[model samples]
Target: MSIKSASLTIVTPNLADTRKFYEEHFNARPVFDCGWYVVLRLTTPYQEPEICLMSPQEGMQAFTGGAFLNLLVEDADELHSELTEAGLTPMMPLEDHPWGDRGFGLLDPSGVIVYCYHPIAPSAGFEEYIIEQS
Candidate 1:
């Protein structure tokens, strides 16, 4: 089976704030919004839905913690600068990782850690983990 697309829906107590956070930082636009639920898609050339935010319904529970969304960008430093100037404080400061990228993290309103990064040369011992895509 082939997966055409996918999105992660997080139950959040702050649905509006979560929606606004993604819109401002990730160039996300809502494809659907119904007071308690919002689906957001990035305005990249591909324009695919990437995130969904929803209020906790009767049987649902708000996300407490432990979700990390990693986004690969063209330039991490540039985006980090822009986000910093926009008043976002990084939870994880921008730095090169021995695992092979430069990145930083921001906490969204719904308790998700959004990590933005760009590829960098892998540190010596980590090079073996890079797999070429066929």
Candidate 2:
């Protein structure tokens, strides 16, 4: 069967702060917002998202860092500019990847490593494979 895209649920320490970080920086708004969990996404026109902020427990150390997700954007540089204007410091500057994604990394309010990227070119191999489908 054909599959769609993927979105990762990242358990965070502070849902509000994490939510604000994503909303202000990446324009991720809540599709579902409960006290313990939330589903956030970018706005219309560019609607695919790759990460979500959720809350497991207040201090589950395992859920704190590198909740290990990448968020694809139309232009990482433009997002960076917006984030800069919003006073968020990028964990890394935008850089070119040999693998074809122009990207940078950052930390969410809850300490998750978020990679913001735009594909510079099609992926090297597996042209037929959609990551969400594989």
Candidate 3:
């Protein structure tokens, strides 16, 4: 089956900080920003995996996990470096995936994992990359 949209709900002790981090690095801006809570989308010139940032009221049942939310990039090393230089510590470094992708993961305030990546031998023709895998 083909995959479509993916989403994750997040929480932070300080929504402002988490929001700013995403905005600064991924160039994501909130479609709805209430200062304490927001819903963001990546701005022009950047293709993205529709992501939303949610910061609920204290004690709300917000989703939390160590699993990853991935973002595809052409160059993981460069992007990872830029993030590190800007003072964001990557929880993982560029590494080869057994499934034929190069990538890394980052941990956010809510412990949500974010991955930046590029598929190895990435297909320009959709057919090639759509092969079924176990």
Candidate 4:
């Protein structure tokens, strides 16, 4: 069976702050918001690939954030500058990786690692692992 869509939902006490972080830094728009829960999307013309932020419900555990979110963007350096100018600091500075990524990491309000990257050619040993699409 083909998968239609998939999304990751994060439960946090800082739901609003997290939502705002994504909205301001990632160009995310709220597709759904009910104060305690919010659905955000970075793309305007498509659905799916959403990030959901929710306040922990009664009897539920809130996320303390050992999560990582990877965002593949067109220009990592430009986005890095923009985020820095906007007063957000990167947890990991922008750099090229042997694994074919030029990326940086930032910690969100809830302590999640939001890594933003762009594609780059992998170093020799790493190139063999990349699967080319048919």
Candidate with maximal lDDT: 1
Instruction: Give me the runs in candidate 2 sitting further than 4 Å from their true place.
Output: 57-62, 121-134
Tell me each candidate's RMSD, in Å, in order: 1.4, 4.3, 5.1, 1.8
Against the unseen true structure, what C-alpha lDDT does each candidate score? 0.90, 0.73, 0.72, 0.89
Candidate 4 backbone collisions, by pair: none
lDDT of 3 by residue, 11-119 (tens): 6655666677778888887677766667778664655444566666767866556567778787888898898888888788788765667888888666777899887
lDDT-based ranking, best first? 1, 4, 2, 3
TM-scores of all predicted structures: 0.94, 0.73, 0.74, 0.92
Task: Highest TM-score: give the candidate number.
Answer: 1
Candidate 2 lDDT over residue span 1-134, tens digit each: 87788777776667788788777766677878777778888774756564566667655643645454677777888877877787877788888876668988888777777888888754657445545531
User: Which scores greater on lDDT, model 2 or model 4?
Assistant: 4
Give the least accurate 10-residue stretch of model 2, judged by summed lDDT. Answer: 125-134
Clashes per candidate (backbone, < 3 Å)? 0, 0, 0, 0
Residue 14 CA error for candidate 1 (Å)?
0.4
User: How accurate locally is residue 15 in candidate 3, as Cα lDDT from 0 to 100?
Assistant: 66
Task: For residues 1-134, write the lDDT of model 1, one tens digit per residue.
Answer: 99988889999999988999999989999988898988898777644658999999999889999999888888999999999999999999999999889999999999999999998888899988878821
Model 4 agreement with the true structure over 1-134: per-residue lDDT tens digits:
99887788999999889998999998898889898889998873444478999999999998886889988887999999999999999999999999899999999988889999988888999988888831
Show the colliding residue pairs in model 3. none
- Judge candidate 4 at residue 21 and give its lDDT: 97
